[model samples]
Target chain A: MSEPIPLLMTLAYVAVALWLGVRARGSHRMDSLEQWGVAGRSMGPVVMYLLMGAGSISAYTFMGAPGWAWSKGVPVFYVVIYLSYLALIAWYCGPRVWAFGARLGHVTQAQAVADRFESPLLGALTSLVMSIGAMAYAVLQTIGAAYILEVMSGGLLPFTLNIWLVLGTIAIYLFISGQRAIGVTNAFQGGLMLIVAWTIGLWAAHRLTGDWWFGGVFERLRDTHIDFLTLPGGLGDMSFAFWTSSIIVSMFSFQQPVWLQWMSADSAQSIRRSASWLPTYYFVILPMVVVGFIGIFSLPDLERADTVALQLAFQQMPPILVGLLGAGTLAAAMSSSEPYIHGTALTWTRDVIRPLFKLSERRTGQLARYLIFPIMLLIVGPVAMLNPGNLIMILLVGLGFAAQMLPAFIGLFVWPRATRTGVLCGLSAGFIVTALFTVVWPNPLGVHAGAWGLIVNLPLFVAVSRVTRPASDATLARFMAIVAPRRPTSRSAGEREPTSSTIT
Target chain B: MNHRLIRPATRRGKALLALFLLVILAGLWPAVLLANHAVLILGLPALAAWSCLIILASTGVMLLANRLLPLPTSITQADPTKAASGPGERVDE
Candidate 1:
């Protein structure tokens, strides 16, 4: 890897992000919780599009996805399959959350959940679970940025220095500008990820095989090593059940950023309109997966799966483009990490420490910044440094744990019978089972632990709720505004009928 | 129609629900077995071709489903004329 060009390019990229971070600061003083965490509800459709898209197609998409394609073969497309419908889920869930945010002044997912369920305990529980999930996710993104630094530098910058530089940049912007910086950077990064994925994928495919070109990379796989073309994949490490459940599980994890972005936008229609273009944005990842497929034959027994995309870029692509690619990959990592770091910070200060000590919102926002660093650096970053298997492993661990949020979220607006006690019990039980499966001992049968946890989680939530009395009709009706169409408006009384969404 | 079809909106939902389960089945399991064949489509292994097509089709289905969805009153509640014009106009609070 020609270190200097990539290093300079990446430095320039970081500088631009820093400038944007500074520029993102509003004219109004950053005193309140909304200004800092949500960027004052000023983001438009374009910003929302990039924010939501980059929230997903992160280091995981740029690096982990292609790596999975190299290692896992066709099952790697599970990433594509699962994500195709992601925006729809957001479209359905987000508007209601936005309405609640608008009417009730909710900012975080935990706050919304707590408010809807009428239980601070549930909010606290959500905060704890999501905080762990978000911080752990940030660590992986940190590691991703560090790995890119080392790769681009050809190991001139050691892992320790690389991580600090990467995390330090993120931490600074997150500290000063908060969500505005993240939104602006995400728009930039989202565009870069698409461009780089295509450039490298096409170049690698052409340079490596030259047989069928970029279009036929998989065909070449079929001709030579046929296993990579099919599902249940090369080694049969996953079954259909596993792939199905895994896709479903990922659809639900740590969606707080998407929710927050939805609420932050000017209107719910903006959220949906922004989301409509996401599928096209996500299609950029396919080329990167093709890059990895190009690698399987080209690199020929590469030492590590994750390095395939970078390794190809270094070997074949022009020096300046390679440098820009490094920047783009880092963009992919840092764009998502900013939100997770801020989210973890908010949850820790708002849900955990505040409830215990009863701190005010303005004070909690200040303290949260101080709190984000240690939580990220110490607890989460250490686990990532342990090199917990691979990039996808770390991402899944966070996502699987976070996917536990799904049942409670769906129950919030959709299930009138759902109770606070039941949701709390379900989340706790599911999380424990998921942890055991993910960390200690996976089930012998080969289904994903998150899936197994859902098996326990859904039934238990239903059973517990059935036994427990429902929340007040007031709570049920308020939350039900999402899935059910809007209540019919009374022209005279100025009240909405329970059944219809139309204004009369 | 059964209780599942209490409304035309719910009917579309049922159709989408069926499609959802089908997509899941198609995403995994017996659907992917087509890759075992030697055929090729557009330079992909037949199974690869099948899977890629499935992904594209799924996206189409989702977009179509979204189009078919009952427009929430919230969109109009934000601004009546703006909802019809589609997303560019600035609405006053």
Candidate 2:
């Protein structure tokens, strides 16, 4: 691949992203905090779709997903099960959440939970945990981006520049544009990556190795402990039961941020519209798996599974195509990292700093943007220093933690009987349990610690909610008013129900 | 025979479509792994030609189905009739 062309392609992607960011700048004139955080509570379906998709189809879609598929085979597609679960949850839970945000003026997930459950402490704690997880996740993305750049450079760029460049550019954009820029850039990145993703998949499949049975590759894998197709490869791999539950739990945990994105939609109907199409964005994963399978066949002796895409693209494909693939990979990384960074910062400002310090809306927003600098440092700095061998494992670990939030969040929404004290107990129990299991063992009885945590957490949630006093009816009614789709005004008056398609 | 030839549009229909796609991809894997033959569509060795056609056609059907389905109302109703000027009115507002 021509060095100049790939560099130029990278520049082109940045330029298009910047142009979209600039175009979106005029939309940031909200006086309220909610407006600032949630895009003035007016992101329509199209923007919502784009923003949500961008938030999701991040570096994982490009590199991590395929990288896993390349290494593990079909299990990677298990990630899509999360999307199916999310869509179902959104269909049922989304309208209420969006309504709650709109009516009560919820700008952040912390606020959404806090107001619903009427607990400031829960909000703060939730925000803190999200921030920690997101920061770790974001830094991994930075590391991945840096790896892609380093790979593109064939080692001349020192790999670290990718993290710096991505962080620097995003910092500038995030500072200038806020969530608006993030939303716009996300939309652009989502679309660009989707196109380039299919292109790379098709090109790689047809061009390299030309559909020959990978006998040599099979022989290589067969020689190893893994069957290369089945799990429990020799004897020590995770059981099918454990794998399914882990996927289910991990995917379910990712629902919150994805759901939070739905709240930004201009209309609820937009969420639905996006849902109908957004799963297609997920179609990128299958192609990634194909890419991974190809990598396994092509580079049988590769030491690092994640680097397969970069290695294949550079060595085999044309320079121009390598550059495009490079951008797609970057898109994947940024899509995941930028949202995590921005969301972490936003959560900290809203759920932690503002309530603690009683800062004004503008000040809080400003603080949120400034918070990104340190977060970018934390996220990128550690990985660069540590150089973790398996970025995918780190990502899955984060997913396990992220999944623990589910029990707490579901309690806030459905179990009106759920109390602040009980929730705190459940969360504490879940967190401790997950941490303990993850730290101590490979996974007790072949199940992920996250599965164990949920197993412990849900029963606790039920017991606690049952034994405790319900949140006040006033609070429940207010929450229900915002979240429930049909207001009496809309229902009895025979009005056209508000469209739920809003997505960003 | 009609039931066999024509797929049901029940929840089963959507699942079937998804399953069909998965089968096609899965079937192609062996060729991908072993045959060393380029994937052909109308005797053309372009995977994109096959995949793109799938994307375009499927996306169209998805859009059409979604439009026809009875969906819940949006969270916000922007009725020009109400003429209520809110801060959210401007895309740049």
Best prediction by lDDT: 1
lDDT of 2: 0.61
Tens-digit per-residue lDDT, A1-504, candidate 2: 336777677657766776776666685663334544556546666776667666766677767666776666545544554554354445445555665565555657777667666777777887877665676677777777777777766666676666677788887776666667777788878777778877887777666545433333333444452444444322225356665576557555743356457666666676666655664566666556667767876777888777777778877888888888888878777777777777777888877888778877578877877787887676556565477776545555556667777755665454445667677777678777777777667478878888887888777877787777766666665543333333322222323333212111
Individual DockQ of the candidates?
0.16, 0.07
For each candidate in turn, give its C-alpha RMSD to the true structure in angstroms: 5.8, 8.8
* iRMS (Å) per candidate: 9.4, 13.2
Residues A1-504, candidate 1: write the lDDT tens digits.
445898888878888888888678757555555777777766787888888888787787777777887887767777776776676566556666666665556667887677667776777778776765676677788888888888888888888788878777877777777778788888888878778877777777777667434556766777777767665677678676777677778776746666667767767666766765665577777778887787787787888888888887877788887887799899998887878887777766666677677777688777876776787678656766776666555455666778877767766656666778888778878888887888778743778888878888888888898899766665555454444544322333222223432111
Q: Across residues B17-81, which tens digit of lDDT does each residue of candidate 1 receive?
A: 66755765675666656454656677655655565665566656656666776456743254211
TM-score of each: 0.88, 0.78
Model 2 Cα interface RMS deviation (Å): 13.2
